[model samples]
Target: MLIRRAKQEDYCVFAAIEADCPGYPSWGANGFAAEETNRNSVTLAAEFEGAVAGFVNFWILRPQVQLNSLAVRGDMRRRGTAAALLGKTLEYARKNACTAVDLEVSELNSPAIAFYLKQGFEVVGKRPKFYNNTETALLMRKTL
Candidate 1:
């Protein structure tokens, strides 16, 4: 997989990936495009076999990196595409002198929770009704 900065053309693909992921809080293509104006945001696309397979969006906040979103195509899951995207995010965090990576995932998304746990993240807190005012959100963090 080739992980690189996401360009305008990749936004729709990212949005489509989000659409395929049920329960994901999607930031539509326009929302992804708008990130270009945010100095703190970094969006990346994972290209596999010449096709966009996944994407990750995060914010560099000096002492911390906040992972805003991540998703991989159903066929791309477990193929290291997601991991590669996340690995790049961690690499950026370390390069920026960030001490930790933080993110909140829907409590209902057990697969994501498991993935993060495998990536050395630990659940540190929770926000009730954080997802559409229905599902709780599990706040997880990995201290570098």
Candidate 2:
């Protein structure tokens, strides 16, 4: 897998990957396109065999990088695609001078929570009803 910063041309592929990943908070194509040009954001893509397979979008605050979304294609799960994307995002954050990285995972998404935990993220807090209806969010953070 090849990980690199995403360009505006990859928005369609990014949207499609996010659309197929069930647990993610969906965003419109235009929103992703806008992220590509955001000064404080980093959008990354994982390509395999010349096709986009996964992506991670993050926002760089002065002292922290907030991961906005991460998704791997349905057929590409369990193959290290997500991990590569995340690793690249963290590297980008570090290179850009971020002191920490944070993200919110839905409480009900056990798999994702486990993945985040294994990736060294610790739950720092919780937000009630942060997702749709009664779904809660686990605020996880990793000090860089």
Candidate 3:
């Protein structure tokens, strides 16, 4: 898989991937278009055989990078595409001088929580009823 910064033209593919991935927060095309223009945002794509297989969106805040969203095509899960996208995002954050990476995962998404833990993220806190009114969110962080 090839990982690289996403271009504005790739938003359609990015939006499609997010739509297909389970546990993704819903966002419209215009939302992604707006994100593409943010100076502090770093959106990345994982390409396989010339197609986008996954993507990660992050924001560079002072001293830290906030992992806004990470999604892999449903057909592409379990193939390390998400991991590659995440690794590239972390690399980008480090290059941009971020000292840490942070994200919130839905409490019900055990697989994703495990993936984050295996990638060196630790649970830092929790947000009560953070998703859809009933599901809580686990706040995870990793120091780069």
Candidate 4:
């Protein structure tokens, strides 16, 4: 898989991927397009076999990096696409002199929580009813 900066054409594909993830929050093509104007935001795409397999978006805020979104094509899961995308995010973070990475994951997403843990993140806090005012969110962080 090849991880690189996201392109305008990738937004539609990303939106499609987000749509496929039923319970996951989606930014849609419009949202992704808006990020193009945010100087601090970095959007990346994981390409496999010339197709977009996954994507990750984050903000480099000097001492910290906020992981905004991450998703992999359903058929690409368990094949390291997510990991590769995350690895690239970390590379960008380190290059930008970020000391830590932080993100919020739905408490109901046990698989994602486990994946973050395996990626060396630790639970730092929680927000009750953080998602859709129904599901709670677990704040996780990884110090670089």
**Residue 46 lDDT (model 4):** 96
Q: What's every prediction's RMSD, in angstroms?
A: 0.6, 1.3, 1.3, 0.6
Each model's TM-score? Answer: 0.98, 0.94, 0.93, 0.98
Q: Which residue runs of candidate 2 sit more than 4 Å off their true CA positions?
A: none
Q: Global lDDT for candidate 2?
A: 0.87
Please give the lDDT score for candidate 1.
Answer: 0.95
lDDT of 4 by residue, 1-144 (tens): 999999999999999999999799999999999999999999999999999998999999989999999999999999888899899999999999999999999999988998999999999999999999999999999999
TM-score of candidate 1 relative to the true fold: 0.98
Q: What are the runs in model 4 whose C-alpha is more than 4 Å off? A: none
By TM-score, how accurate is candidate 2? 0.94
Q: Model 1: residues >4 Å from true position, as ranges?
A: none
Per-candidate clashes, comma-separated: 0, 0, 0, 0
Candidate 3 lands at a TM-score of 0.93
Q: Candidate 1, which ten residues in sequence have the lowest lDDT sum?
A: 74-83
Candidate 3 segments exceeding 4 Å error: none
Q: Give every collision pair in model 1.
A: none
- Please give the distance, in angstroms, between residue 1's alpha carbon in candidate 2 and its true position after superposition: 0.9
